[model samples]
Target: MSGSALKPATELARGNSVRTPNESAEYRRAREQLLAEEIELRRHIERVAELRRALPPGGVVTKNYEFEGEGGKATLSDLFGNKQTLVIYSYMFGPAREQPCPMCTSFMGTWEGKLPDVEQRVAFVFVARSPIARLIAAKKARGWTQHRIYSDASGDYTRDYVSATDADAPGYNVFTRRDGSIRHFWAGEMGPSTADPGQDPRGAPDFDPLWTILDTTPEGRGKDWYPRLSY
Candidate 1:
């Protein structure tokens, strides 16, 4: 009868067989809202990037800290291993701890494969506040041979970087040279907490891209997922 009374099969076969002007307008409005939300999200990301760039230069550590390397004794600079900039991640693996932290281990597992690509841009190292022998054993067990590993047996360097408080936590610190002096650029200890919004248990924020990617499959990186020294 009316133009709106199209055959059901026709409507089903051609998705746009019949739509009132009002329906089209409502669809456009919904699309505009989604686009606006995307734009706002992009703006928020840009703001966060600006804040990261605006961080003030940090103080340098004047005192040299000693570490044990595969080659024997080494200094903090040795961790750099001649790279211009050093990115150190403080791993939560100390002597007294019950076990090596699983979250840190997971992060390190990702790093193991990524180290070669990253080393091309900047030097990367993992520092544990454990004995050199203990740290080396862990590295060997985990098959982490591509990247440099060191032990800050004494907590001096860990404290200097603010990655540890008398006790070490999983954290990352970046250092660079400004003029003739070294300066800290960025540090993050609470990254795990920040990245895992699902931990809130109240209202879940948009999940992190890393977690979301892992979540797209049936097996998913399960809770029992952990890095093993020997796999």
Candidate 2:
């Protein structure tokens, strides 16, 4: 071994292998090694999250945007709801589309069950360009009872945070409301330019459990497959 070489973390892992009838020594060794890597990967994810939290406060939100929800009009400040941090997911459901983007719907569906736990630390909501009634109907149809959907009827917020021309796109924007002022915190900036070959444009440490789960299978997430609204 080279003088500079270090042992892989597998040596330090306490993970054990299953005693399945067909399991082999080689399989145990490989799994134990992967366990060590998984441990390190988890730590790495937290470190990246910490770094993201440490970023200097992002741009100050100058526009006092208003949106329509189930109860009527609500300004950006109203969305903050008692929490200092607010996360708004700009969904890709433009007024012109007969249906919302399947990808965005899939993403939103993932968060439905987790919203209650997530909101304990941060306020969260979904925004789309569709009318309030349309957005509400879709949410109900999807059986998403936890989240509140809103409409950027004027496309003002969508244009400002997502696309300059009001293109149908998905955006993850975070903001901070403090001392009577609100400021942008961060947004998922990864896009086509940052995409690796054969992969879609996605942020590091992909938050989607669906993709993560599919990645563990032999078929993997094929290039053409995507979530559907029905069946």
True-vs-predicted CA distance for residue 129, candidate 2, Å: 0.6
State the RMSD for candidate 2: 3.8
How do the residues 29-147 of candidate 1 rate in per-residue lDDT, one tens digit apiece? 55556555555555566666677778887777587778766677787666666677888877889878755777567567766777899898888888887787877777777788785
Error of 1 at 137 (Å): 1.9
Top candidate when judged by TM-score against the true structure: 2
Instruction: Give the per-residue Cα lDDT of candidate 1 at 46.
Output: 64
lDDT of 2 by residue, 1-231 (tens): 231354455655654534567888897777787888886787677778888889987889999899999999999999989999999999888889999888888988898879999999999999999999999888888888998889999999999999999999899999998788799998999999999998888887887889999989989989999888889
What is the Å distance of residue 35 in model 1 from its true position? 6.9
Clashing pairs in 1: none
TM-score of each: 0.67, 0.91
Q: Candidate 2: worst 10 consecutive residues by lDDT?
A: 1-10
**Candidate 2 backbone collisions, by pair:** none
- Which candidate gets the maximum lDDT versus the true structure? 2
